[model samples]
Target: MKADVMPKPQNMFQAYMLLFLISSGQIGVGIFGFQRIVGMHSDHDAWISVIVAGIVSHIVVGLMFWILSKHESADLYGIHQHLFGRWIGNGLSMVMMVYYVMVSVTIVRTYIELIQSWIFPTFPTWVLSMTLLLLAWYGITGGIRLIAGLSTISFFVILFFIGTLYISPIKYASWSHLLPIGETSPWAIMKGTISMGLTISGFESIFYIYPYIKDKSNGAKYAQYSLLFSNIIYLFMMIMGIVYFSKGQLTRSIWASTSMLKIVKFPFLERLEYIASSVWMFVVIPGLMIYIWVLGRGFKRMMGWKQRMMTPIICFVIFIGSLISQDREHIHMLSTFTGRCALFVVFLYPVVLFLFQTLILGIRDQSDKKGAAE
Candidate 1:
């Protein structure tokens, strides 16, 4: 199969922006309530699980870069075609596209849930879903360079949200809550790491976005840096959740990160979480745009559908998916299902693909050498 055409110089972005793209992509709505799920298994040692998950992500990302580096100007869709052939590869690519769509839907619905729960109790879900989908559609139409710029801005918005957490949440922390650490068994910590699958899964965007990066050699370096940055933010939030809330409280509080923001009071404003929830749209939109762009690009590469024409169609599908679950139970079910799928797609698949590719190349090389000798 022919390799993908290299993006134009003006369309490509600097290697450094990988830091922002991967970081913003990984730190979405998951951060708000991941503490409860993770803490349920490992308790105070949940932070250790966060570290383990981060290390594992770094290794998986290394595998992804190795795979992409083997073929010039080939993204994940092209790699699939080369490995599995036209029929099977397109099928696999479609699976990935579907997963990306599901992830986008989860982010939109979950964020809208937060908005309705915290700030506006009577807010209609479809209205917010359409509004966010339109914003994401606009960003997708602008192209990858535009999405990269939004990711950069989202990085700073994340910083602002974290900065607000430190001000009030840390004050109420009970350091003793973390006493007698490492009491959790190894098995439970591993379970907690598995539970963290969804929150840390977004860095895999590197697979599709790799071909568009201007500096190929340094791409891995910047991707690792982005993972480290996100891990630090997650670690901080996990530790704070452990200290700020009692064991029962931590497990019960669904939106621990935003719940932590409830205490930040100023002379000017009364409810800080209300403001944080609203500003979180800035962070959510960029992530949604990145995933939708990947979906549209995947269809274009594998099925020859134009990204410009397919983008709005993809957003409409996401909108429909988002509207499927309105209650907390159904939304939780969607997030949980997505998290489990992410474990295989984002983490395990890369290692499997890398090993298979290496083996196939080795066999081909040996055959070529034997033929030349004969």
Candidate 2:
């Protein structure tokens, strides 16, 4: 931790705890919809795009940590002030505030959509929203420690889903279908990588968790590696998605993962997807809670509140926003726009911070050396 950074909530998580929170934030509902998006473009090459996108995000997230690791402690808001003057930093901070809110709202809508599609149709949307909001408020109010504890459990469940792919042999996977990487062009693949990158977008929450880590000195190392873990896990999922979906079968399907499971049969279990997807809340719940917690943290920072004053207000706002989902198209539009906005903070913000910090440090070092020589 940098000398300048203050421990907020006056307590920090162990390295392992921090790692769990970051990874949980990375893993989410993306896995469920991933195969559908991957099948839209190239065949097996979807896996290639997955690797490419993961590498790109990995590099960008590394730069994010490099900028934060330079100062004793700088939240995104603090980094804005460090790089930009007060006015510009203030402006950028507001942009981040909007980004976090949009993210949480979009996720809230998605959660509702999933519940309506899979579990509950007759349940009033408001009732589902309120229940989710209640559960999230409890977790977010407890702070990062609770988030980490929940994530550790979710991580194990998510791993079992990834491992389930192993039960079906890849020898059945057809290669003639996957032979052509780019029947169209490299441009198409790039476009797919950019679009489907949403599946892996959860890694950005490290910005919120940096100050919460017990060891700041090696926090970047831990973050980068945790992201690395996320990348590899995601990559494996993509490969399994491609191989499992096949080529022709994927072309005609709506949700490739759902359709792919149509072949799965056992004496005891008829629909593996039903049972499998039931545990899926493991991924969705923790993911929604994390973004909500980050939203709460932002409120806490801006309001300058005692613990008592801050959390309730934050939870109330999130609960209210959960009612914003009128339909699927609306939620999709919100998610799409928010994801595009996230690109600025995720991809562009760190580069700007790195350049500004480097330039300022160089100037300060020169001034120090000149003064000593005089």
Top-lDDT candidate index:
1
* TM-score of every candidate: 0.98, 0.87
**Model 1 C-alpha lDDT per residue in residues 1-374, reported as the tens digit of each score:** 55565888989999999999999999999999999999999999999999999999999999999998898878989888887789988898888888898899999999999999998899999999999999999988888999999999999999977976567878899999988889999999999999999999998788889889998999999999999999999999999999999999999999999888888888999888988888888888888888999998887887788999999999999999999997999999999999999999999999998998899878888999999999
Clashing pairs in 1: none
- Which runs in model 1 stand beyond 4 Å of their true positions? none
Q: How does each model score on lDDT?
A: 0.91, 0.69
Q: Candidate 2, after superposition: displacement of residue 261 in Å?
A: 3.7
**Superposition-based RMSD of candidate 1 using all C-alpha atoms, in angstroms:** 1.0
Off by over 4 Å in 2: 1-3, 8-10, 169-172, 182-184, 246-254, 363-374
- What are the per-residue Cα lDDT tens digits for candidate 2 across 83-161? 6656777687778776766666666667666657766677687776677667877776677788788998887886777
Worst 10 residues of 1 by lDDT: 1-10
The number of the candidate with the highest TM-score is 1
